[model samples]
Target: MKKIYSIPVFLTMMFLVACSEDFLDLKPIAMETEETFYKDFDALDMTATAAYGILCTRDIFDYYIFMGYASAADDVEVGGENTNDWPQFQAVDRLQHSPMLSTIFDSWGYCYKGIRMTNEFLSRVDKIRATDTKVNQALVDQRIAEMKFLRAFYHFYLAVVYGGVPIADKIVDPSMFSTPRNSLKEVYDFMIKDLKEAIPYLKEKSQLAPNYGRVSKGAARALLAKILLYESSYAKNYPGDERFAGMQERWTEALQYAEEVINSGEYQLVGINGERFASWRNPNGGVGGYRWIFTLDGDNSPESIWEIQNVMDGKGWTYTRGSYIVTYFTVRYYYRPSDPTHSDRVVGGWSFNLPTSYMVNAFGNQDSRETGLHSVPVDPKLDPRFATSIGRPGDTILVNDQTEGEKWFPMSFSNLPTQTISRKYECSPQEYWNGRTNDNEGPMNVRWIRYADVVLMAAEAAYMAGDKPKALNYINQIRKRARMSGNTGYPEDLTDISFEDIVHERRL
Candidate 1:
């Protein structure tokens, strides 16, 4: 097994414990230690890539975080064949999550793995000579900026979950193992500092030099805004929390960063009825923009600010390491579709992250959100997004000509209002998943931060900053798109932007 040292133990000792006189007693280095391995830009770049790669792994992105959010949120339920299907998921859904559960530990472990790698890069890269013509000194510095952002990003994740985690900001030494965990306030401050440093060095979208996967200044600023918002509202529950004394200032900062992303005009929503609509594989394809954002082809879509990338190419048991998003969140019993007009595009579900009545009712049978979640079979015309984003009773949900009315409901026996299936992230129509005889893995990208989220953040920040008109405008933009998905125009009557309005929109 890999080392099980707590972050508090490892990171604390990083600076305190020095090599001292032990060098004389130590044996010669055997493996490619930092002294030899971090020799050039190539080495540091590969190391940085590996650091980022950890987040793309199966456990972190698709399975763990996907289920984690669903479980913790009140809008969803952890459903399977039975209540005992997956204990960890059940625990999270029930709000009885344990620290020892692999969900918690695996997340903690991989995040630190990423942190360690980033620290290693930061510690070594600065040591390279500027005259080293083989390495573009400017590029090396930017990568160093990337590593800094990653380190800060990992700490932010840890802080949100296990508050006040140890700060592994540098290379570790033996004495650092005894270091204590820092306060959440300390951690957030560190993260803010790192992101602020990273934003300037990060590339802009028009640079067109880096591939879509790399982090950009927009992402850094967006993440910084996210951090500020979370911190602003975080301490409300804790009375007299000294760490949040500057909460108002932090909130203003949040508004500033959010506005920066908005004014930059580099990223915007992928309107379902706009240019992206024609690119949805087919005009009659059974999916919408929100649904398409998580599909395999949705990578680097304008809506996506940052996402995890993967490709299967039909090589081996690709699902083993590929994102299992479709594998788990898919509609169950896909192998045996009841539709006669089915196509090879659909796959089955595994009964995880089931939507609940609250989730269904959140949309209140409104524009596209209602159609995206449940089938409006009895009245397809009522839902502008019906049939296009989901299945009606007789519509195709399987290959070559399968129809849906054959089954009682979703998941073999799902009844609406009480128990509903997800139209989002359900791997029913992946065009590339047909290679595997048993569709256990899918190739969809995992979108972490997208333009929709940025717009929402801007809306929230605007409302908090007393600019109700701007907040309403931003929120209306999202609603307008939802209406557009149904081929319906968003009415211009949404003028009152209240705190509840912002919250309700976010819930959708």
Candidate 2:
């Protein structure tokens, strides 16, 4: 009887204890706890890496949201099977997007999501450094600098797209989730400060290993230059606009930073005068100075200041690490029954972000250009970038299969109303084969910032600062490269480049 009573007593105590809050308070053994995770250098670095993953995800840098951003420009039009397709993009294209828009919210939420990760990592780093002496201080410093750059990058884009966003430099408490937006000046000032502080600790492009897509000092300076240029342009364009008052003075600083990037000796143009980098990944080992910049071969080249790294593994639709955005831009095609393999031709795509006629005509008149074996009717007098940038109705597009070699066919798509496709970002056959899971995945790295873009920004800054000669010099550099890329004698350099010329060159 005593034994039975003791059993019941034990069972009751066990139940009560198990129900108590402290019962499950034990540290997680099989998993990681926040307290235990930041004790080492590698763990903190991994956290920084995870923060960078936000850039690779659909929430921040993927197709749907980016297409929405692109549609705002006249150069690109959102095309699909019909008007009902991808209404989010259509709303933005038509400038009818409201606060209820999902893409805007996604950008906002995911940007803050990235900021939260960086803030937490930074805060935890400080705490661990105070208490733990085993940490690698040097690596920690570099990682901290990287986080600052990334955080500022997010803020810069937000300010540009949706003026005066909230700046989150530290982890926010749940009670303070409704923080008010900062002024545009305040946001820009914060980004400038963070990037300047980070530049010293960040590595140069040359310091990083080949194909290392990490944030470098040149990227930081380039971004700083861009931010200042935008602010200066806004203020100059709208002098009475109080939001950008005094920003006109930033042109000198912008030019300084941009020139710094130009003179850094860490980057240069690839395929200058039709030269090819050994890194060029042409399936047939062909050469096109500017065209290869978008292919897998041109990734992480010296000309690329910053690129969003992507890989072609067998990742499915759920994965965002691959260049899924290319699929949207690629031309949609049907495999004919006679050529069921789609042998040597380009693969199919959903055909979004079709270039408008205004954009195509911007390149100038077309002429018959001579090929090695034949004469193809392309705009020889037009800007050489036309051949590399756009695949028109008469042009042949790339879809090289290694087994069958290179095959060229006329650009034909079933769903394209515009009857043209952007060739700059089409997925190569090599990338398609590598992404065995589906066409949705490709290995093309998104060239977010290139040396050419930096030079152009510098030109704008110089022009805004009342230095026309410097601006002309920069513009001429791009023209020279373009001439060489297409091996054309046309699109001659302007004797005196105007501000309009700078803008027009940028459109190309």
Candidate 3:
């Protein structure tokens, strides 16, 4: 059993006893308990690594592994083997979810697990100085900062989901579990504090290895800008809220941080004709732009700000090696012929988060994300949003086979199966079935943050701060990247940008 820390002391004790042997013998050869860890910088580094590893678990990052956040939005429906397949997910779609939802407990428990691990590291990181030389102090300090950034991230994750989650900044007394929740403002403030402190200690992406995927200075700052933007949203909808009294100033900070990231020059948007996807999985890997971004080829693309790493092998789903959870939820649940080798595709997804027709129509005038090459035979006129906005009732949707590219077709029973499926992260049939349970679990590295999102965020922050020209500039930057080079889409240059326009841009 996996040990879930960061809950009440009694509960953690009970789990320790139940999950392992005696609590007194917390130091097992199989695992390092708090009593044995943090003795040196290396141990602390390992602990920090473990903290980051938690991001891949089904509890937190594996929303795709189970029912995901998309089902709660209006653009999708919780589809599965049947409407009753996952009532908790269905309840989310119906706005009828309760505390009893397993996802609720899982998400909450896993986030706190991450928090607890980071907190433990922070409390004991200083112990490294006792034995390690002073020359390596700065490196130790950077790791500590990374832990702080991760702690802030997990806290923010809980905040957005639970509104005002308890700020588990430290290993607390058992009594803290029942402690009153902090205000959303308080949570944001705490997260912001942690991030700000972490920023100075982190290195730029260029300093790290190309595929390093570790948290860098840009990641921490970019995330801080996002958090501030979210806080600005609260202020926008409720101006009377005192916590956001200086919302305009906050917006200014958001823009500043965003620009800082852009100026760093360490990362860039994956361009329309970039070599990032030169040969992602095969020779026909020239699907530039949006489709290219989602493939395994773009794992460490310049456009990717931060992402969870995924190796094609796995000791377990929660070990963070690679994930098939996205395929589990996004792919159509049933397989055609129910055979492993007939060449029919898209037969194993759990059919969750099915796109609504409204979503299909929302992608108007562009297909960067929507109906681009990866789309079905839906109408050509659509926004470049929601990658699967195309495909007519009976149109054929292509599936990539691991050995070959886009050769097989989905074996569907319905006349218009593509209408209900999302092709964004679905793996090829061969790759999906390469292992025992890996098909439900696959090797798609889930991208948590990317440059396009940051660009839009900067645009929104500028608009909210009463800078129309700046907002238009930012929006246009994203728009330019969304289309092929030299083909800047409509409103070639927006003389003015409005809040509603920003909203529409975000939707796209």
Give the winner by lDDT: 2
Model 2: lDDT to the true structure: 0.75
| 171: Cα error in model 1, Å | 1.9
Candidate number with the higher TM-score (2 or 3)? 2
TM-score of each: 0.80, 0.86, 0.80
Q: Rank the candidates by lDDT, best first.
A: 2, 3, 1
Off by over 4 Å in 3: 1-37, 64-67, 240-249, 272-276, 279-285, 329-346, 365-406, 410-418, 434-436, 485-495
Write down the lDDT that model 3 would get.
0.67
Q: Each candidate's lDDT (Cα)? A: 0.66, 0.75, 0.67
Greater lDDT among 1 and 2 belongs to 2
> Could you list the CA RMSD of all candidates, in the order they appear?
11.3, 6.0, 11.2
Specify the poorest-scoring 10-residue window by lDDT in model 3: 371-380
Worst 10 residues of 1 by lDDT: 371-380
User: Candidate 3, residues 336-357: lDDT per residue as tens digits?
Assistant: 3336654434455665566666
How well is each residue in 1-508 modelled by candidate 1, as lDDT tens digits? 2466676678778756765677567756776776676667787788888788776657666677767656788766776656787888889888898899877887788888899889878877766645345988768767877888889888988887787889999876889977788877788889999999998888876564447667878888889999988887765445487645443335668888887887887877666454344433354754456545655566777777776666544344422445666667655543234456433333355656776655544455333433322212223233334333333233323332144323233234332222445555543243544454445356667788877787888888787778888888898877776665554443223657676666666766
